[model samples]
Target: MKPSTHLVLLLANAASGMAVHDDCKLRFLELKAKRTHRFIVFKIEEKQKQVVVEKVGEPAQSYEDFTACLPDNECRYAVYDFDFVTAENCQKSRIFFIAWSPDTARVRSKMIYASTKERFKRELDGIQVELQATDPTEMGLDVIKSRAN
Candidate 1:
């Protein structure tokens, strides 16, 4: 093994590690116009298997009249929640959808922010989307788009 070869291998490995670490962030991507915001949720855990839409200005009570949605591997759901775009949480990370996987420790599931509700609905036909909130007083989204079953 040559010294130069070892050095190249080491650098490559380091770069790969960095890419994996930032997989959840999608640092190389940007939100498109009218798409709002987006992020990557590594995996959807069993306990929190649900996708909910928190109405604008609505409270986040389990018994609240909010909509509760679910997703299976064969089904796609449109998420339209505005509670996660705060200056605090949004700055730290971006997580929009959970990656449905069997591995409990799975990480990095890419979720895109498609442009426009009409386009989203049109493209994702046969899929029920979490309609965007129509009012204020709502800031929480219980997006349980995954299930254990």
Candidate 2:
């Protein structure tokens, strides 16, 4: 019999050797369900071979604060709860999954981040937008706004 699709996917994930910690999913649920946080920054712990939360933004935090949490020469994964007004003057919000791979980061770090991003993102259930950024300019507020619209 052929391997089931689910089995194949599970095997592929196991092969990657990177795990998303339980808290990562829990925090995402809080943001998605209760709106308790504005953003979450994730980092790969090379020693543990797991992805874990680095920082979390409070509900009152600004977008600039979220941007500041990302480092200048490192790779990170982040999720932002973006709130904006529509053209009709109605309130709207979007969950953005960002892969931050700055050009100056180590090649191995970037490669690992890139390869594991899809699998890691699957753990978050309600992500509405995805952005892969190589520099600050690529993920600037204007860029996120355009994508949200």
Candidate 3:
């Protein structure tokens, strides 16, 4: 896949307003955050095995504002940061694997619901390190690993 003109060749979390209907597979880490930002939308090109990372602006203080452009196609994933939040500040402020509902979305926010923050942090951190070490530019990592030349 040809990279986009505006594509930053760098880095990348969670489940939100997300429906449990689609068992969203964590697609290795598609992006890694080079600079700090509030929200992200990965426009996954499934056919081409590529993703376009969109670093969105913030005041991501509201759920609706944060999740307005969330992907529902079962391909791309969304991740967001909530470091600016202080009210119920506990641990995991990051959210990812945001699956949009086919019927009506049911994403879990750390702010609104009782959550498993550590697990999400572990996953996000691991992926961030993994991506930084070896950036996979294509979807054939498995195929290549299998010695399918």
Candidate 4:
């Protein structure tokens, strides 16, 4: 599939929402964090055809669980620093996560519920992550491996 196709799935999850399987909630959260951001730029390596995610923001919670759930073949890494910039009374914070696969991406097909924070702080204060399926082939590494067997 084309790179744009993968991007379309990411955008759709950001705009609407993703429906992730019960077993893949953690992976879905990781992808949601990567896809939806507080404005960031990506540098894709043409020769390797890999996407590197970068952002300028403050440190928030990490998605280690999400990363650990990824397929063994997929490379997952994230870095965060303090760079909060806000003018309103509501304090602004941000986090960045990325889910990159060598040949495909993960796609979800149900309305899954997720939150960054365990408890609801406020209506707008709660943190969330979601996963949406781009295509049938976008299942996480584990799913692919299981199906292959």
lDDT (Cα atoms) of all candidates against the true structure: 0.27, 0.92, 0.33, 0.31
Q: Write one digit per residue (lDDT tens) for candidate 4, span 1-149.
A: 79977766665454232222232333323433553322222222223333333332222433333333344433232321112334554543433223233334222211111121111112112232222223324444344333322
lDDT, residue 12, candidate 1: 43
Candidate ranking (TM-score, best to worst): 2, 3, 4, 1
Candidate numbers sorted by lDDT from highest down:
2, 3, 4, 1
Identify the leading candidate in terms of lDDT. 2
Give TM-scores for every candidate, taking all chains together and pairing residue i with residue i.
0.18, 0.89, 0.35, 0.19
What is the Cα-based lDDT of residue 5 in candidate 1?
Answer: 72
**lDDT of candidate 3?**
0.33
Candidate 4, run of 10 with poorest lDDT: 109-118
Clash counts for all predictions: 15, 0, 12, 9
Candidate 4: stretches off by over 4 Å: 1-20, 26-73, 76-83, 87-90, 101-149
The 10 consecutive residues of candidate 2 with the worst lDDT sum are 6-15
Residues 1-149, candidate 3: write the lDDT tens digits.
44642222211112222222111123223233442445555443323333345435354344456554644323334454433233465443333334222222222222111122223334444322111101222212342222221
Stretches of model 1 off by over 4 angstroms after superposition: 1-68, 84-149
